[model samples]
Target: MKFFNKTGKLAIGSRLRMLTEKITEDAANIYKLYDIELQPKWFPVFYVLSQGEAKIVTDIAKEIGHSHPSVSKIVSEMAKQGLITEKKDKADGRRNMVTLSPKGKMIAEKIKDQYADVNAAIEQLTAQTENDLWKAIEEWEFLLEQKSLLTRVGEQRKNREGSYVQIIDYIPTHREAFKNLNEQWISQWFKMEEADYKALDNPQGYILDKGGYILVALYNNQPVGVCALIKMNDPVYDYELAKMAVSPTAQGKSIGWLLGNAIIEKARSLGAGKIYLESNTILKPAVNLYHKLGFQKVGGRPSPYERSNIQMELIIKSSPFQKTAE
Candidate 1:
């Protein structure tokens, strides 16, 4: 009957729901032993109202993370059992406010010790696990706060089904999308320094005006991927491959390859001598992609970025559309 051990790690949501049901069942048993009539399902709404304050059903639902309809049903049941009372709010006559009745308050006072004992039992269960469940739950909640579970799932789904992608040269309107995509990747991997900000925030000033090129990958007419080739100050290298990023949702669809080739071929068309790039070794996928494109590791120059741990240069042999002699 225990699902936690049987279903294994990937069934986390299932395991948590099962654990909640077991805890509710245990609390119900404790109430029975204490000679108190209470259902575990009614605990959240009742507890919120038991603080000597009247609250509307909408407020109760929000505080307890239940739907309005569910709380409404529970309030109706509590009223039928003579455990609570409902009346129109003084401030808003149309809205009903609920409060614990005298009988309900008496029951809560009688079972206060029993509730404490139930909570202590649950605390003891946490000691049985290698990691404290409360701490893990807190961390997980914080992470979900940063990026919701629904968003992460949706991004994964989009990554798998990227069918319509069009690689195009960057235009004036794509300024924001290019900046946002680059900022996301840069902030995740490393801090966005002054140089990065200057380059991204004003691409025309830092890139196109200096004879550099930018390529954008569009999915459904929205720019989801971007890469840039910036003309270098040094004579040896003509352009520095910089600010390449694909949207998390549009990734894993060879969009990187699409943007990379687009920019590289653009460099060849401009008759660039050599294309170089700088990146950190921690970005394994990006570094690997550069290697696959025939970019070779070279001696390091004094980099403006602290994240630079790898430098590469690409020697494009010839244009793809052009053939070589035997």
Candidate 2:
């Protein structure tokens, strides 16, 4: 854990540079393997046009951060390939409007499929490594965004059941079950402070008020576990995981496991790339659970919690998940 040391600045930078090269190499390999003749820069240009609504060539160039000449050349080549068509703008005839041609649309669809395949291949190669990479990126981005940004706020565990788990959302009137789970955590580890206990009790007031979501597990019509999706306004990432708890009665039954997977799936569906959480080291089961669920530990940062906490994060993607019963 050299990166965790206060003097680990060099180690951290080296690690980041290595990751960048690896990702770049991976991208190049994917394009070669797929036999995609389209250059990396053209993907964004074609993607923008495929989204409908004719766009001015200049605007497309600006949006993708490419120079006018560069984009112009690429667009011209695409037109020759019958992938796109350019027309003079009616209001400003000097400006050219770009639209995807039939061939262009087909190419766009193929690009989308190739993108999904690349992601699947990466996931298969890295497994949880993807999660760790995202967590590091989010943490670094957060630090750069806020001068007072803190890291390593808590530790979490992985879901016991593999990747797929039954998830439940919109569990109104399940406050009592969650309260019971909080009590179980307090009794088994350390008593929950009054404030922390209160936060768990009022999910709507404490969590949802901050643009978060509450989910609970049910068995035979009984509440079994609970977790929340806490929205982060930080520019680094859009959401965080908070106030996760499971009843001691349901501990060995993988209730929390399902709850964790459900939250991860929900976050991914919402277009979130990273999820952060806070927990204590004393909660060994919880720590291990987060790891199993693809969460990784990072440097500690300041937070409202009084306990010695560890922070964990999971990277999410748009991979399909099985629909759960309502």
How does each model score on lDDT? 0.88, 0.74
lDDT of 2 by residue, 1-326 (tens): 54547556536667767777877677777778776656555777887898987998789889987888988988988888787888899998888899998877777777777889877876776674636665676797778666532222211222333223345674557777767776776667766776576577687787777777889877655666788888887776678787677666556557777788888888887878899888889888889999999999988877777764898878775674433421
- For all predictions, the C-alpha RMSD in Å is 14.5, 21.9
Which model scores highest in lDDT? 1
Those runs of model 2 whose alpha carbons end farther than 4 Å from true positions after fitting are 1-166, 320-326
Leading candidate by TM-score: 1
Give the per-residue lDDT digits (tens) of candidate 1, residues 1-326: 46567867658787789789988888788888998878889999889987888999999999998999999999999999999998988898999989999999998788788878878887888878798888988899899999998888777765655557889889999999989999999999889998899899999999999999899999888899999999998879999999999999877777898788888888887778799999999999999899888899999998989999889999876755664531
Clashes of 2: 21
Off by over 4 Å in 1: 1-8, 157-326
As a TM-score, model 2 comes out at 0.45
lDDT for 274 (candidate 1): 92
